[model samples]
Target: MRGKKLADLNVMERIAQEDDMGTMTKDESAQFKADRQAAQAKYGQMSAEEKAAVRKAAQQKRLSDLNTMERVGQENDMRRYMSY
Candidate 1:
């Protein structure tokens, strides 16, 4: 009987399996720190109700955009079948 062997995966799988620590380059490290500080300041100013409303609005916009594009794609596909 032959033994089964597992296949070696790519770097992406390894990265996903491990924790992130000191993985960024110098430039990325600086930018990430700046972004984090900026986000903390902005989020600190928003009330809980305002934050909830903003998240809801973002979700609604994404859903609406997805629906609109899906409709446009279906229309285009239907036209292809109906043409003489």
Candidate 2:
């Protein structure tokens, strides 16, 4: 797990990596499953335009997060150089 990227991990391995307790409580797991099913049902009822909008929004959010991460890395490098 040390050198493995998230995409390289299998589903259970990824879940293990993300969950510090290594497993969810039974109630929490049940709630999560119900939420997922609900979301799937809602999405299934959405029109194609709505689905595309959702995907576009998600893509935009990912791009925004990537930009923020890159900016933070650059700032960290600047701070390190300035301290030298």
Candidate 3:
């Protein structure tokens, strides 16, 4: 696995790639920090109810995007969990 290219990784291996912080490139880290700051600024401007609504809407959209197997896995509390 040490010498394997990203394209050669399996589905679970590809998914696990996100768990390795060293995998992030400098540009990706900068972009992620920028995005997070923007989201934090936006959230800080929202009221309590507005925040709840926004979170609910995002959850709904995420659930809708999942396929049957993923949804079923979620319902069953599988090892592979979805994140927001």
lDDT (Cα atoms) of all candidates against the true structure: 0.68, 0.77, 0.81
Clashing pairs in 3: none
User: Model 1 over residues 1-84: C-alpha lDDT tens digits?
Assistant: 024222454566655556566577999989999999999899789999888777777655654666666867666555543442
lDDT of 1: 0.68
lDDT of 1 at 20: 65
Rate residue 11 of model 3 by lDDT: 91
Q: What is the lDDT of residue 78 in candidate 1?
A: 50
Per-residue lDDT of 7-57 in model 3, one digit per residue for the tens? 999998888986855688999999999999999999999999898788777
Model 2: which residue pairs collide?
none
Which model scores highest in lDDT?
3
In TM-score terms, candidate 1 sits at 0.41
How accurate locally is residue 1 in candidate 2, as Cα lDDT from 0 to 100? 79
Write down the RMSD of candidate 1 (Cα, Å).
Answer: 12.4
Each candidate's number of clashing pairs is 0, 0, 0
